[model samples]
Target: MIQAKAPGKLYIAGEYAVTEPGYKSVLIAVDRFVTATIEDTDTECGSIHSKALHKDQVSFVRKEDKIVISDIDHAKQLKYITQAIEVFEQYVNSKNITLRHFNITIDSDLDDASGQKYGLGSSAAVLVSVLKALNEFYHMQLSNLYIYKLAVIANMKLQSLSSCGDIAVSVYTGWLVYSTFDHEWVKEQIITSTVDEVLIKNWPGLHIEPLQAPEHMKVLIGWTGSPASSHHLVSEVKRLKSDPNIFGHFLKSSQLNVEKLIQAFKTNHIEGVLDSIRKNREVIQYLDAFATVDIETPDLKKLCAIGEKYDGASKTSGAGGGDCGITIVKNDLNRENIYNEWSKNNIKPLRFSIYHGQ
Candidate 1:
């Protein structure tokens, strides 16, 4: 059997504005992961199993160059898996390789045992893991960028509104400053070009740069019990783009703050990093007021407030209606007080560290 794992991610800055091409965001991959394992099957049909889903395995067959799940109801649940398989198979077909039946088992630690999501980019991790497993199984020796492009293609089929920073972090697996590609350009290219052609060409405005965190800085994560729908919040924020004055201001401010954060990392200025985090939080707060979408919930407010009390800079992590909020502090600060305060406020202090890629 062949196995692959992809790490979950937390956005440090640049949330809503990062959807635009050339806009940059910072994120770190966490140690929690989604893993995929592939094994050859004797039968003509292949199956997919995930403990998070149903007890029974879902069977599928390749017909007319598509992977069709046997059980229609579960098809939607397993869309990411099937989509990754189809896109990877397209690349394999380009190389004139015949496919074989295989069974895939998916395991994830991104959520609680009771199935409560921590908003850790489980979907992106799942797609990356599946593609990685398939790449290894076929001995493709594909580059990380190639795998990321394939994952993006598969992901866009399911959700077009995403910035796909999660997908990039999953594939690269470390601290990163990511800029989104031109979504409209990729959408147009998908209709006209083969997967191989698209992979070989330059994706306009997309950039991923790895960063080294300063030794004096520390990162902390707090999870609010309430789950958030990133899609809904992002969609509401997208509406603001129609009025360029409000949206443009948001984009400019977010870009400035993210650039400051990136530079702070490069210079080993821990104070500069903390200041940027605080400013980024203010930027998001301004966005919340203009968009009328509550990106930061009450619990998230409490979470950040507690972090600030301990002399750390804190802010909502992702699209943040209520999921995870990040805090950055100096090494001398005591994190236990912050964690205990979060616990007292019903916020769970997640115990994972930054995942440096294996």
Candidate 2:
């Protein structure tokens, strides 16, 4: 039996800029996690048990050649993990010894976190953990970096677009500066880190004080109830960036901020980290029109109203046509007050940090 776990992340800065390196995005591993456990046996077939979601009942799992969920409108949308499974089968087939008889279990706390409901790269965590476990289960000799790449390929299968940042940080286990545009540099920095120290070092999450919501902080998250189409949104943005002038400046600003954050992280300066976060927020807002759109809902409007009283800023979390709204309250005596106010209004505040994928 093999068991593995991966943590979820909260993007502290550059939420939208991640799709295109406009704002250097950072992810941190949070307390919440998504895990996979596998029990190998001599049985004839492989089966999957999804303990988190109880909606599906199947006698068997879908084959790679079968209807991949990535193709269907939505079938768990776990194509990243499924795709990795496909590649693993190919490798296993060449070896001939069947390890098919297995009971796979997956569990997650990626949804409605702290009552904040929306997807935030939960699939990325699942892909990372499963790839590592499967690699070990099959006795495939692959380095952590190599296995991480396999998960990134799985992500590509999902949307044909993937940034190695999410999964890389998940497997790397530390505070890191990652960029998909510069995969070589990202890998270099991550590989250079002593993983043993990062995992065992006692850390203070107390530095995660709430930021003041700038008055300009006009934010909202409109839930379509039906999931928004990330593929369509990604494609539209790609087309817009065809104008070199617009994207050139965008990329340049992002790359610069990334360097500043890297220096701050190296020095272990909390104030510097927060300063960089504030600056990057502006970079993300101006990167593109899709960064913040008209899909923000009325409930989101109410939350903003509450945060306004606290004197801070807010924005949507992901691809942002509509999903979860993230509110940052600047230093104030009323930070907790504002958080409590939102809760009274049925909004469960999420304590998110950039250090979440460890």
Candidate 3:
């Protein structure tokens, strides 16, 4: 059996901006991971088990020379798995290599005890994990960029629009500055083009660069006890972006803050980073009010206020509404107080580190 793990991710800055080409976002892969185990089997059909999805076993059989889901319920829940199988199978087949039947197991530590997702990019992590396992199992010799591209394609096939910054962070761990491919261009290619053609296509605006975090800083993640659907929030943000009046202001402010934060990271300036975070939070607040979108929920606002009381800066991490908020704490600050404050508000403080694995 071959096993692979991919870490879940959080966006530190550039939430809505990354959806557009030429804008940069800072993403960090957290400690939580989705693990996929693949093993060759002799049953002529493949089976899958997912601890996170609560499926004991689901079968996939070769039909019409294509691997497809044979279980109804698993088909709905394990779209990420089946799509990955289809994509990888197609790629390997093109090389004149016949894929063998395999049993795959997926497990994730990214969810809460009650199975609520923490908006840690579980779907992207799952895709990355499964693709990485297949890459290793088949000895595909896929480069890091190729692995990232495959995951993004699979995500686009499953979900209509995706920045894929999460996929990149999972493939290349640690802190990163990420800019997305043009969403419209990617979507158009996926709709009108074949996978092979798209694979070799030049993605003009996409960029991913590794970044180092400051040594004297600490990050705290607090889950708001409610999972926000990134799909829903992103859709609303897209609609809001059409209004030049609202989105135009948001884009400029967000880009400025992100640029400042990155510069601070380069110089190891803690205060500069914290200052930009505060300004970024203000930008989000203004956007929420101007657009009447719930980018920052009441709980998230409360979370930020708590962090402010302790001389730390905090903001909702991604496509807001709920899920987790990130707080930037200096090393000298008392983290216990921040943790307790979040606990009192029914928020769970997650113990996480930047991903250290490739």
Candidate 4:
């Protein structure tokens, strides 16, 4: 069996700010995942299959003499798998490896145990798994860095809201000080000690909700049901960055937000992280027409109402049309009660736990 898995991710900082050149966002890899398994079939053709219960997406295959697979019907799924395959084909063609039939299955632990949240980089996780599978099956010596860039090509292929941070975090799991300006990849430290050490005495990887208490922290992830697209607005934001005034304001705001989050992590102050996310949202909106420049969805308002009562901070997570939102818990909030309440409202609260890379 050719097996592969990719960790889901979330933006910790610089939500819509990643569209610009000098801006950098932060992302974390979660324990939960989306995996793909491909088994070689002796026959000349194989099929693509997905979880039975998941009417969520269609299962398909682009059959040929040798197995060629793609599930591009869902526009939002991105073209990570297809792109990875295309890239891998280049190397495989060099070796003249004859194609073989195979059966490919994609299953996400996200839907099974963790309720799939569009906000957490579920799409990215799936794409990464495809790339890893290709590397394994084709004997391609692709490194994590190459995998990252290849994924970026696929990310921006259909979506322009990439900050390059999500894929980055998915690859190099753990705490990091990321920036697109002065420090591109500084303080690339891993916070997953399993046994809290240095900077963090009780470092717990990312944790999901309605589950065991995290060793380090617990964050609340919310969905907007409808979110304004971040791609267009982010691209517009990049154009504005060309203006001196807009550029300065945008850069300064992002820097300030990062500093605030840093302080929160430094003192293990949940409130600090909450406040920073709240503040960052304002800055993103300040870009006017670049972030949430359109109609605000009720989901945003509803989740905010529920999250405000909990703790830390609550804000929209990604390409923010009305998809999903996230909140960091602060004090002694009742995790169970709120999670149940959210579910009653058709809102799925996920238990997100971070992962550490070896």
lDDT of each: 0.93, 0.55, 0.87, 0.58
Please write out the lDDT profile of model 4 over residues 1-358, one tens digit for every residue: 8888777776656765554444555556777667878777776545555552252433334433122444445423434545555544544554668655566667776543445346556666766777777678767777775666556545544454455566666666665544432112211222122111212321122211111222346666755444345556566566676687876887789877867776667766666666787887677556654433542346665676677666546666655556666666643456766677677777667666567753
State which candidate has the highest lDDT. Answer: 1
Among residues 3 or more apart in sequence or in different chains, the pairs in candidate 3 whose N, CA or C atoms overlap within 3 Å are none
RMSD of each: 0.9, 8.7, 1.5, 9.4
Any idea what lDDT model 1 has? 0.93
Minimal lDDT window, size 10, model 4: 202-211
Badly placed stretches (over 4 Å) of model 3 are 191-194
Q: What TM-score does each of the candidates earn?
A: 0.98, 0.69, 0.96, 0.69
Off by over 4 Å in 1: none
On TM-score, the candidate that comes out on top is: 1
lDDT of 1 by residue, 1-358 (tens): 9999999999999998899999999999999999999999999899999765644798999997799988898888999999999999999999999898999999899997778899999999999999999999999999999999999999998889999999999999889999999999998888899999989999999999999999967899999988899999999999989999988999999999999999999999999999999999999998899766689999999999999999999999999999999889898456999999999999999988999999
lDDT at 154, model 2: 56
Give the TM-score (vs. native) of candidate 4.
0.69
Residue 340 C-alpha lDDT in model 2: 82
For candidate 2, write residues 1-358 as lDDT tens digits.
8887877654545544465532455554555567889877564556665666643422234464342332243355445556767655554554665646566677787676343335556778788778777877878766665666566545655554555566766776544445554433433433453322222232221011223222322222223233445555556656657777766666677667656755665665545554665566556556544433333355555665676566555544445454555555434455677678877877666554433232
The Cα error of candidate 4 at residue 194, in Å, is: 40
The order by descending lDDT is 1, 3, 4, 2
